[model samples]
Target: MKLLLVEDDSDYAATLSRALEAMGHDVVVARDGVAAIEFNDRDQFDAIILDRMLPQMDGTTLVERLRERGQTLPVLMLSALGQSIDKVDGLKAGADDYVVKPTSVGEIDARLHALVRARGWKGEGATTLRAGAILVNPGKHRAWYGDDALDLSNLEFKLLAELTRHAGSFVTRTMLLERVWGYDFEPATNIIEVQIRALRRKLTASGSPDPIVTKRGVGYMLEA
Candidate 1:
């Protein structure tokens, strides 16, 4: 996997970069947030490690900018402050995970693996998943119907992958929220319904049959 390390501490960055490299990961180091953004715009990375304090641009600003540009790459924010509020602020700024400084290289590597796994959780181990004519490739993060590729958002891909994995089996909305969205508590908002509706529309846009079967008040299923 490729990683972008945006940190100002030269020694820490060098040590961490070496560790990741030894683990067979391609690591790109940026000394500051401005350089980080420039590198990010020019290169594609599997994950990003960011420091909260940076020269020219802060990590929060960088994260917000990346999100605004629709870049959904997994970001793990690193900070010296381990307070819950600090963590919350980082997440709210668009980081996928947060870790305090003085962390072990092993722990950082483990967290990186977890964040990347979670991002591609739906397609991690599976090669091909079929639900009627729809086919999904979890490894490649791609999906298709017959010969046509389906353009789906990150969330849509995860939702489709989950349903297709359990084809012919009922999957409740709560399960989707918990598994796909990583939500522990149910939100009052109908996010599942909204996303499903969007997915259905995209599926049928090419005149394909809707493989997703709504189970009314119970949940959803993909017919075999």
Candidate 2:
């Protein structure tokens, strides 16, 4: 899952981001509501873990704004313990679920899964995504190009899934590093180049034209 984690506490955010990434979820941290909005606008995410009390703009207000913008993605609000709770406000404002701070990552993961299932991802988070002849089913951990089954390693499968998710759009190296590799820092190795080449090779081995496009220094785009 690609996740947007909104929190102001650096230590808590870092700790939670590590835990979530260890669970195979790609997490992007946003320190405040303003930054959260920017991240939300620039990238796609399966869900958002938001802090209720945020600087610049509060979580509830942010939820309202997001809804007003026609964004229906699941938002799980994090409320600090001992604070006055407002279940009505959050629900009315369009937050899907609420979790108290200091909750287990397992619980958060479960809630996120449940939310996705309940909403059926509003089609955007469908179980399978397709890019022209390419088909990727993350839930089943399988992919295919045309009629040929793709026997992909875990990394290749993830890379393909990311490209399929944003079909026709350039998925930058930085985005792939964060989403597909789950790395906050860029490594010295040419992991992206290697994996992309492997994917391209497999994709075209069956006599199909290469659908993945290299935009020079920009990034890669999978033809739609």
lDDT per residue for candidate 1 within 33-83, as digits (tens), equals 888876764555788999999999999999987665445678999999899
Q: Which candidate comes out best when scored by lDDT?
A: 2
lDDT of 2 at 172: 93
* Cα displacement (Å) at residue 171, model 1: 44
Candidate 2 residue pairs that clash: none
**Cα TM-score per model:** 0.54, 0.55
Prediction-by-prediction clash tally? 0, 0
What stretches of model 1 exceed 4 Å from their correct place?
A: 121-224
Give the alpha-carbon lDDT of every model.
Answer: 0.84, 0.85
